[model samples]
Target: MKTGTNNKFWKYAKIITFLLTAFVVILSGCVDEEQNETESGNTTNNSQEITGTTNNQGTTGGDYIYGTAKVKSIQIVTLESFPVQVQVIAKGYLPDGCTKIDEIKNEGEGNAFNITISTKRPKGAFCTQVITNFTETIPLEVRGLKAGNYTVNVNGVNGSFELPVDNVPEETPGSMSTKQQIITEADNGTSISIENESTFYLKLKENPTTGYSWELNLSQGLNNISGEYCPPEQPEGIKQPLVGAEGVHLWEIKAVSKGNQQVMGIYKRPWEKVTGKEENFILNVEIV
Candidate 1:
């Protein structure tokens, strides 16, 4: 009788153990599903994702894998000398390294710009590095408007910026003097050392017609004297003015401190969900 009792106890124990194991598996599966759902909320296809950069040298044809980066926002700001300022914000969840923005244009029919911010491969860069997500802002210049209406769109979202009569610059070109030194796209990775307070003129190449623009990532210690979009310089040998020509983004930064600070920019489309980063640039400045 004791032997029979022992057998019964062992059988019941086995059944309970099996039930617990099944329960654990089911619970684990549920937890995994929840995580995936949350990620998918702002997620797109890995192929279309622009969160970070990869070391692989791929083309737009999907031959290679690029970092996922896309647009976050685009807005137009009206300041003293700047009549039309396009501010762009892009994100790279995975950044390969620092990439320079190639171009930003106005591609849309009604004053739309396309932003082309891509990584600049070094002399021997394989570009396989993929870092985590970080946000970047790039500024583009826009000018020559007749004080009318315009639209700045990012990731399919539109931000309307108006140039009121009061914000217009003086008609007499010689009356106003610019106190800014410009910083262009080529100034990336370069450092500037200053003793007293100084200002910078940041000019970047942009094509706003394709829905891309630039903006200054607001920071402390640096005073913004002015920001504006200057009209594209008329290319030589061209007679007629092009409707949407290549342009330059002009931004002025006043450094008021005497230490080290890093300036950043991001080029992206703001409306779509992303998995990687757009193009990014980091500028180092020293005030001594």
Candidate 2:
């Protein structure tokens, strides 16, 4: 009976040892798997952080990042007046709600204009993943350019426009074009006939240094284009122009309608009340 009891006790001890060893092995495998998963997650996060820092084109005010805008289309609009004016309409999209148009730069070379539209957004700010639409109207500096076909590039979108004539005005009396007509104070109180849609210049003498200027009034059939003050010519030996000297007040007018038109001017200080004794000039024009 003693030998049988000892044999049973040894068997039981062997079974207990085998179960403890299996439990330890399983626990060690679980721990190693968890560590490997944690290491892999950290590596992925580090790679994303590096990419985010290197992809931006630039930074603004140490808080914003700059990127190029995505332009979709462009339209060219030309005004219907002298010394032609051109405007460009650009349409584009933004990547997110937080992104906004930052700047627009235009550089002209030869007959081509290159325009850059830039975008800005706060760095690392959470924004809606929605697309936004944008439109911008920009004017071109075409004053000195000769008449021809010109190309415009706005953020890689291309367009073209044509200027049938030079976009420069007749600035001097000796340089007047065939289409420009001249009138002086000597023509006041006289009636003249001109072609329809013709442009005329009214040159009058005044002394603005005394706080007096020419106030012009146009009839409904005419259009007052522009008025400018021409300073008196300085003597050859004199370096500075004469003070309180006489100057010419030049006005550019257009006859848009046929029939009778009138241009009237009154010389007086703007703050002073007008009286019948104030000097005045008038002209009658017939457009046919």
Best by TM-score: 2
Give the alpha-carbon lDDT of every model. 0.59, 0.86
Candidate 2 lDDT, 1-288, residue by residue in tens: 999999999999999999999999999999999999999999999999887776653443458889989999887866443576788989999999999999999999999999999999898889999999988989999987899999999999999999998878868864425556667765779977777888888888788888899999899988989989988766679877677766787888999999999999999999999888888899999888
Q: Candidate 1: misplaced stretches above 4 Å?
A: 1-181, 234-244, 272-275
lDDT of 2 at 139: 92
Tens digit of per-residue lDDT, candidate 1, span 1-288: 999999999999999999999999999999999999878765765634554444344443334233224555443434333443545555434355544333444354545555544433334446667664545565645555555566665445556766564334447754433544446555677865544476777777666666666645745657767767665556579866456555666777888877787678777656654445766667887766
Cα RMSD, each candidate: 24.8, 16.7
> Which 10 consecutive residues of model 1 have the lowest summed lDDT?
59-68
